[model samples]
Target chain A: MKGLKIIVLAKQVPDTRNVGKDAMKADGTVNRAALPAIFNPEDLNALEQALRIKDNYPGTTVTLLTMGPGRAAEIVREGMYRGADKGYLLTDRAFAGSDTLATSYAISCAIKKINFDLIIAGRQAIDGDTAQVGPQVAEKLGLPQVTYAEHVDKIVKNKITIQRRLERGIETVTAPLPCLITVNATAPECRPRNAKHLMKFKHAKTVTELQSAVEDYYKLHEDRPYLRIPELSVLDVEADTNWLGLAGSPTKVKAIENVVFAAKDAKQLTADQKDLDWLMGELVANHTLG
Target chain B: MNNIFVFCEIDEGKIADVSQELLTKGRSLANELKCNLEAIVIGSKLEGIESEIAPYGADTIFVADDKRLEFYLTLPFTTIIVDLFKKQQPQIALFGATSVGRDLGPRVSSALKSGLTADCTSLVIGNHEDKKEGKVYENLLYQIRPAFGGNIIATIINPDCRPQMATVREGVMKKEIINKNHKSKVVAIDVNKVVTDVDFAVEIIERHMEPRKIDIKKSQVIVSGGYGVGSRENFKLLYELAHVLGGEVGASRAAVDAGYVDHARQVGQTGVTVRPKLYIACGISGQVQHTAGMEESAMIISINTDPTAPITKIADYNITGDVSEVVPRLIEAYRKHSK
Candidate 1:
């Protein structure tokens, strides 16, 4: 089997699953410490799909790529812990506050520089339920896209067969190679972290450590030194400078108003003819019984 | 100044109510922007459908009827809309953010290279209304969409693009009453614009009849249970209560995660967002994500054991106690009072 390069798109979102009523900050932003760090559920599902493809086909290497703060490297190690061959974190202060459009541009640029056959991503991040990044990435690449995919039925050579989840039912779709797939939660659950993988990549670090490792490796083994996934500099990718973040983003935040819920109190009216008739009138007026 | 197009969705030969809702909304947008609102219907034998849409206030109906369109295919739908968009050049477009809309909106918008916002709860056309830098165009229409999962709202403008598009979720707007006597113009377009390919690798084998037909969006009242409901077995009581209330049953994300219900009934960030007249939350702690869907409920009732549960703070009537006790009592109260 040929060595197949696979890239999985990962994102760092605030741990919204654990956010309580008071967990939100005064500014409407989530308090980071109050929220725990865990892989986005769908992204984990995406990695699960990637690992399945890797396991089914020999000589396949899975690479995790993400653009976020240095803390997002934790997701890369998470990928490693889940059996990915390598992980790459694309972090720069300049790439902040990006909407889907700008975010897709950055990802597509990074994808063009990598050698890969498939790009698997969670259908959408929990924090931003837009479900746009995968499809937008596909548009940027000009490839056929399958969103809300439940499972991969078969991968016969270059053609991949999948079950695309529909609203009431599911449809089986087969697309040619080099296509992007956004895995919904239907994929098998990602495996628990393997202890051996944790020990192997426990030394993974920030770009600084990664760069320093390259120099150390160069001095230690002149010909065959260990090479981690390289940190891509801005110049290495074709991301349009104007479209990098907020500037390319045509959307501007108008406001953030926290929503509060208050329940209504209404005693049930008895089934007497007059009372029932009046209640019926109210329900009909309110369109609750209509 | 121009025409705004809306995709009129139809199901089982009847124009889906959301189309009328879109027309009601599109009417306002067209009125605000000083343009004609055009309703586009694409399906077989939909001749008099325009009659139904007229009272809602569509100035024109672009009808493209064909057998191929009877059942939706992504390719044909996208191709037809793309062709129509190229020719009509509407200033804006709208689609219902349904399962069908979610499936079609992105493909159509991408094919046209036009901007599209999905699942918007609100629509506010910028006051810039009629800004034309040149006779060709200026003062572009800015479409505002909630971003970062509703953490903040963002205003989006497509200066160089034609026909700004948005897929609004159902229940965000109300449908206008259909009046057969209402007036509108009809323009029939060629249906054979694209070569129809009947061969699709995927086949729909069978559809198991869903035991319960619950369209959460269409349900007027929703009885939702949460983690405080205790266990999956308790959900039967929630179902009983909902049945007695003559409403559909729903669940918080917590209950769904606990394996109490299907994803369809789960309401929240990852679940369905619903706006009902009477939203009864049983044993559910109100989280922002969970509240996003039901906050718009005309009336909310929280029955939970925890007095300080988040649901209690926002509840109009908070019955602080175990749902196990309160729910049965509420059911009895409803039955007793009604009897």
Candidate 2:
């Protein structure tokens, strides 16, 4: 009968699904500039789940929390355009090159600074595909986690029921409030941006963006406090330096190389009748096909 | 004792295939490091589970049988595993990249302050020299996986962490038994000590696990398509070809994302790893993620308009043409030849 305070962990990631010719460099490193950055698909699913809860609970509030470069603030604003009440962008150079564990550590510290009942995040980000952060964060915060969640069935008596989409079938589980859930893409698609919310939050900007603005908007921000999206630094979250970045990350990248398959000296053929017939004959002779 | 530990997962009354696969891998890695291979199974009514794991050459098997753990709740499983691992001090810990493993591995790793790599394609014993630290570490587990959307292969190492943890997808590793009569030292864990009342904060209300309806992994012959297949209607051609050839139809991740086919039929790193006898890849530019699943097929035939498509390099036969044009011809040719 009461509203819930929820935090949706979102990310801005490169659209890896449609990698282009310019996606990779000559030496096999990622050409990030060439790739388009978009809100992570699964995170959008998680946001939708959070928004649905807010929709059902009349007084509920949804907040978006994202950790990335200043550009990731765009997702926070995007979340607002989709019914989120507010958002915080956690950005700091000290938080760079964090593996899942260190990333979760920093995120957990930030979550502690905020007041929330439930935390929702995508199962995994496309860029890393680790699916480790949600559970890791839950562990760091001493909370239970339900992963691969397809639907949040209901909330009653401070308990949340979720339908999880496992490899084989479906499972329904219940966890108390102040827990975490990681949503899967199999859930419903996120609702489209609202025209009214979009018009209202279009000018929302992080501190960094405000500093780099071509025009002076200090007076405007002072007048409209809601337009000032909070940007949290490592110190703002009270995270230790040793556990914030690459230093805190236990996993080290030993090596990275372009994917190169061993050439098998394939016999080249065309679509001509002769080539097709010959290929079929060879396959039939070898019992490769009926 | 520093040993290699595998968190063997159980479904119903049997050990999961991925768990057995990891046990097989953990055994070999233990052999290479000259350490003991250990396995931990946490569930209810798991009395004779050790019999299944002993053949994998595990020197020790830890069983924590309790009703609370029969269904995997993240907290309880993590509590049991983290406690055991803290005492055992395993050098390497492995888990399947299944739903349960992915949920439990990171929690345990976080609790123990360890590193965890997910969906690793290969695990090898190697050495790493930290130039910055000026330290050379030997016999590290090389957690090799496809990174950045399968564009590159990254080998990760946890130089300063204990129980270097990693999760591997099912069907990625080969499962073999060392000896049928091998015996293992069984250790029973006190569930009440490791798992407390707080661990049961989550409750399972209902569960329905269905048998896999479309299992492409067991298909002997596969006709797979990709984004280049163009449209959902075009996928019908692949289905027809597969039907005529008495094979199954598979789709790449791109095709599945495009709504051309169901995700169940996807063949790629995020999907199923299949080793069919004959694989016909139609209009699929071979991304490593897609190839990782089907590269080991007995024979591969790639049909793409692009001559330099990466899939061609690994294909035994490269047919340069459109799928629409090439597939029908192959189907006709096969029909005529077979008759």
Candidate 3:
């Protein structure tokens, strides 16, 4: 009924959707440069839900809060182009190699510095696939969280109704405002970038980006405050140095192996009935089926 | 003593297969560590749960059966699990990467300040060698999972954390019944001790389970479509083929995200991993994201217009033709053959 402050937690992940020969390095670490970085797929779904809320309730603002390297600022701009009112990029050298726990810590710290009535995020990031950061962030903020959210059905008074997609069925639950909801991939796809919004926010740059730009865009940023996308470092959020990055991250990578499926066990067959019958018979014989 | 723990999930009064799979894996891990394997079963009226998991290799079963826990509510479940973990202090904990586990695992791990790796495809005990980080942890749980959409398999380790936690996807590990006569020691905990009024924050207004839901993961045969399926309307052909075979229909992440099918039917790294007896892939190019989920199937039949499609390489039978035509013929042939 009243105005709302919505924050969509997003991430810029290496397009894990598309993998090439150089996708992984010899050491098994992802070759970030080989794959183009794009906004996390589900986060875009979360953004759509947030955008819908903004549409229903005018004066509501949707801000994207993404925590990654300096390159992650791109997702913030991407979010703005798709109608996010503003964005914040949480990046710093100390925040490198953060697992879900540490990542949530940083995001929660930044959230504390912002005004928000609803916190929305993707069920999980494609790169990590942990799906923990959203819930972990909610826990850190001491807020109720609804995971596997398919839709925000309605908001009556301070209570919000959500439809959750589960393996067996759908459940409709209600949580009070100031809660967290992680949108599933089943949610609506984000609206395409508005041409007007794209043109308006295309020039928006973070302080780190503005300083390194080839063009003299500092003067333009001064003239238009909205053109400036705030870059918040660890210190900006006043996060504890000890709980910022690898030090706070309890999970460590032991090794990475590039797995290629071998065709050694496969037997090619024809599409004819005889081959199909033989295959079916063989499966039954082997106890794979009956 | 350090022990291995499993969170046995119950759905519709039956122990989930994934939990049994974890118990099978946990039994061996506990043996290697020279410790006991215990399971936590939380539900109401769980009279036979102990006997149910007895053959799965757990030596102990902790049950928290209360009316409030009859259906899973996040806060209460997390509270009890956290309390039990703190009291028991198991060395490692495993959960099924399902809706209940995904919702509860993170909350418990975060509350306990422990690290949890989710949806692991493989679990092993090995030394963690991080040469770049100049650190090596001996005898750690090697939580192996496909990262970056199944592009690479990363072995995650919680070297310094207690109760190193991980959630494994269903069908990734085979559940072996060790002893049918085995009896697990049952220990019931009082729910009132750990639960509080504040834990009931989110209220469940309604729960609806769609009748005859297509559970592709458990289907004996799965007919999956991909980008080659063309459009949402064309997916009906997959349904027809699957129907004739008495199987369920599945879709690649591309197809699901394209609105061809529901996310529940998605089979990929981002979706469900299915080890069906027979997997018929139509129009799917067989990206690792798609293949990794169905790689363990007994047999793979890929139908694609492109002969050189990567899926063809791993497919036992690669039918190089248009799926729209091939599927119809196959459906008709199967119908006639059955009749």
Q: Which candidate is the best by TM-score?
A: 2
Q: What is the DockQ for all candidates, taken in turn?
A: 0.15, 0.42, 0.33
| Candidate 2 lDDT, B102-217, residue by residue in tens | 99999999999999999897798999887778999999999988787765678899999998999988766667889999999999999998778988999999999997588888
User: Cα lDDT of all candidates, in order?
Assistant: 0.70, 0.89, 0.85
Candidate 1 chain B has its poorest 10 consecutive residues by lDDT at B199-208
Which digits, one per residue and each the tens of the lDDT, describe model 1 over residues A122-190?
Answer: 987877676777877776786667777888877776778887775566667677668788888877788
Instruction: Please give the RMSD of candidate 1 to the true structure.
Output: 9.6
RMSD per candidate (Å) reads 9.6, 9.4, 9.5
Clashes per prediction?
14, 0, 0
Clashing residue pairs for model 2: none
Query: Model 1 — TM-score against the truth?
Result: 0.70
For model 2, the stretches where C-alpha displacement exceeds 4 angstroms are: A18-34, A261-290, B217-339
A1-290: candidate 2 lDDT, tens digit per residue: 69999999998988886666676655333555677899999999999999999988888999999998888898999999999999999989898778999999999999999999999999999988999999999999998899999999999989999999998899999999989999999999999999999998888998789999998878888988999899999889999989877789999888776544333579999989789999988876554553
Better of 1 and 2 by TM-score: 2
- Candidate 1: misplaced stretches above 4 Å? A1-4, A18-37, A209-227, A261-290, B10-14, B42-52, B63-76, B108-114, B128-162, B188-212, B215-299, B302-315, B318-339
Residue A228 error, candidate 1, Å = 2.2
Candidate 3 lDDT tens digits, B232-274: 8899999887765657899999988888889999998999999
